[model samples]
Target: MKSSRQLSKIVNIFLHIIALVFTYFLLQGGSLIIESLPNRHTQTQLEDYLDKAQLDALDKSLDASNLEAETLSFNQQSVKTELKGLKDVLAIQQQNYKEMLASRYVTEDNQSNRQVEQIRQKIEQGRVAITEVTQKSNQLKQQLLQNQQTRNQIQQEIQDLKGEARKVLRQEQRSNTLKAFLIRLLFVLPLMAIAVFLFKRFRDSSYWPFVYGWGYFSLYAFFIELVPYFPSYGGYVRSIVGIVACFLVGRFLIHKLQDYLEKKREMEQRDEESRRSSLQNNERNLENSFEKIHKGICPSCDRKFVSPDNKYCVYCGLCIKRECQTCNTLQVSFNQFCFECGEPHREVQENEHSEEHAAEPNDGINSSPPTPSGV
Candidate 1:
């Protein structure tokens, strides 16, 4: 292919050479045409001048012969004098004709010389123009050759760039594959180990199947890297298989991790509940001890009790009320069932005792009053 291209280029160069040769011939032919054009015009003008000079000379000779005839016919002295004057006129006319002829020759020679000079100048100008054109053509050809060389260099550079790019791309692809493999090993391998450990702990042998499947997937990934020349569709198929395998393995690992965490959380929760229950029991025991130390008597029943001044009596339904001994004022009991006096229920006992003593001395004074019957 390269040789053929070189041959084609050689053929094109030969064709350009042929074209330049043809152009040189064309320019030469044009110079010839320019040179002949002025000569042809000068020749026409010279012929016309010669014909007019001949006709003028012939007319002058005829006029001189007529003057001589008039002289021969005259016999008088005056006529003879007139005939001499006519001969003088004929001589002047001949002299004037000779002067005109000389002037015409000089004028024609001057015009012919000018025309030749013009033709020569035109030829020189044509040569100059041809030289300038040839110079321009040479410059153009040089520029074209330089441009062709530049284009060839650029094409070579492009090809080199493409080759370098392909090399870099291949290197990058390999680097990426290696990096991916390392990353997968760093993450998936540890995860697989953890899965295996958990599987042993849980005694679930079924997890081994997924481990084997992941091993197969790793092998497949390795194989995919090995056969890099495969078509895009083939690579796509391998990628799909690898993805599905990785997904399945990942799902299994996640499920195992979830189960492990769930079990751990359940155990921790049970321990936490047990600790909470123990704390609650300890709090309840402390509360009981505090209650025993701060016991007060229930005043409603007038009984000797551990919880004196208790608002609700365990033995009786009556609310405790105490009366002042000095003013007989009724007050809610809080100070050992009586807020009015330091004496514990002394006023309420005394009032009830007097009434009860009047009724029956044997009954120890009724500290509480009985409900009145509606009569």
Candidate 2:
């Protein structure tokens, strides 16, 4: 009989686990459907909302200005290079004229004088050429400076256009995010409602495994899928939601505890026969009572045992042990069959046990209680 009870418990656990596995698969399928229902937004698609025409025009203008500045800079460099070469040539010509003037041979003095005058005229012309080249270099430098200023202005305009475009893109992204959140909320709310109904209506029914499985799935969906999408608003919204959930759950638990106490008080007021009959008919309640008895507590009153070997509960007067009629062996009162002789035991009524307890002090005993109806 003990082995049979153990087997039933194992089977019950296996069925509950199977129910949860199937429920997980259902949640996966539902999540896929919900995700497909929304018109999802992509980063690139939102960017398309910004008007980029002005930005593009500014970019082109910046590029053209950079190119013009580079050309002007190159021209300035070439003019400076030419000016350096002209100055080198003028220096060589002036050095040759000085060497000739320092020569003192009289016969070639007159010829040397005429050569020196020609050299002086050539040096003056070279000086005029250097001045012209220097002026050209200066003009190139001015043009390059103007080009640099224009490029700077273009760059500044491009920066302003880009900043405006970024603002528009951000607005579009926020709007799309809100839409996605609403779509998901619509899908999950109905599921949560149905789950709540099943929990309240059928949680204790025979098909409780499936009911509990759906309840677990709904809780996961609400906390994982739906709650996280709520607009955080610096965590204020989530905080408020958490507080409300705590209050509702606390209220429910308090009410349930009060109801349990009320029911227990009502049960204690009944006669011993009715109380025993109610416990015997309920397999779950009977099983729980047997478990508590094993722990040395009164099954009916839930009080700790003051002594280890008491035949009846001192606090509640509930029978805890008895002697089998067939084998005359002492055993638990709740057991239906005698462990020693394999003989089925008869039900010992509360009145009979009470009489036996008063008549016999220690060695006397009675038959065991009846089996639970379900068992």
Candidate 3:
């Protein structure tokens, strides 16, 4: 029966261990899935797309500006040089026409007249070329300004799109965090509740070992799998729990130690009082102790002898040796079995044996006598 009870305890412990391991993995696996995908793929991609768009817009703005700058720079270099050269040629041609006009007046010949007319036509053509060059330069500069304005507008649109993307990304992140927390909580809450119930109700029962096992699994699951994924301050929560546990355990141990000490002190005082009383009965107690070492049962009081005898226990008395009924060999009176005969014997209590001995006299007076004695 005892072995069966022990076996059941073992089975209970084993099952508890199995359950704890199963719960650990179940929670850990679920948490792993949640933690691995804390953010949604679509939301992440959208945010990235927005960021890229902003950069692309800025790049396009820069490219367009660079092209316009190069065009303007080239126009400035070519137009200024061409306009200067044209102005110089026009001045020289005008001077040549004036000289031709003055020389024609002095000569008054058909050849001089034709030269003057040709010079005047060349001067007019040069003036027209300068006017056309200045107008073309102005047109190119105006086109550069328009491109600059267009680039600024495109850049502003890019900024607006990027801001929208940031806003959406923040919202998505918040939603995902909530979902993950709920997922972890869903698995943790029920297991934790069951563990607490078992600890409280079955902790001292035949299934007590299971309580410890469940407790260990519950703690590991909460700290390792559940708390880390809590909304915030995971570390603080773990630290506070540990501190409280340690404090409670320390306090319990201290209380137990104090109680034990108090109980021990009270027992010691009682023992001291008993020792003093026995000392007052010293002479009688000494004689009982001496006889108990040899007799095996108390002769002074006919009570059971105390053991470890060099005449010491408080129950020391005249130790009587009882004879084995089967072998007629004396043996220890307090023992229920004979050593030599290997026979079982009844153990008689001191008070009951005394009562039986007192009844023997009454039985003697009530007995019938022999016939000769009666005559």
Candidate 1 lDDT, 1-375, residue by residue in tens: 011256755865665465455445544653464343222112122223233454455445545544543443332344445445555555565565556556657787665555555545555555555555555555545554554555465556545545665666655555555554454445345545654565456433333334344434334334432233222343785687679989999999999998876754553344322322222234343333224324543322233443555333444433333454444555533223334445555434544565777765434332333221120
Residue 244 in candidate 2, Cα distance off native in Å = 3.9
List model 3 lDDT by residue over 24-119, tens digit each. Answer: 765577557655644333235554647675577687777878787788879877998999999999999988888888887888888888777787
For candidate 1, give the lDDT of residue 175: 56
The runs of at least 3 residues in candidate 3 whose Cα sits more than 4 Å from the true structure, single-residue gaps closed, are 1-43, 47-120, 196-225, 232-375
Top TM-score model: 2
lDDT of 2 by residue, 1-375 (tens): 111377777977886897798689878987788667544444444347545787678778878888888887788888888889888988998998888877725456687888888889989998999999899988888887887788888788866666676778776666766676788788788888988999889887878788888888888878877776776666887899899999999999999999987876787676554565566666676787778788988777678888868877676566677677777787776775789997765544444555777765533222223222222
Distance from true location, Cα of 263 in model 2, Å: 6.9
Model 2, C-alpha of 113: deviation from truth (Å): 4.0
Q: Which pairs of residues collide in candidate 3?
A: 292-319, 295-319, 295-320, 296-319, 297-319, 297-320, 298-318, 299-318
Q: Which candidate do you rate higher for TM-score, 1 or 3?
A: 3
| Clash list (residue pairs), candidate 2 | none
**How many clashing residue pairs are found in candidate 2?**
0
- Give the candidates in order of TM-score, highest first: 2, 3, 1
TM-score of 2: 0.71
Q: Please, what is the whole-model Cα lDDT of each candidate in the order they appear?
A: 0.45, 0.73, 0.62
What value of lDDT does candidate 3 attain over all alpha carbons?
0.62
Q: Report residue 139 deviation for candidate 2 (angstroms).
A: 3.6
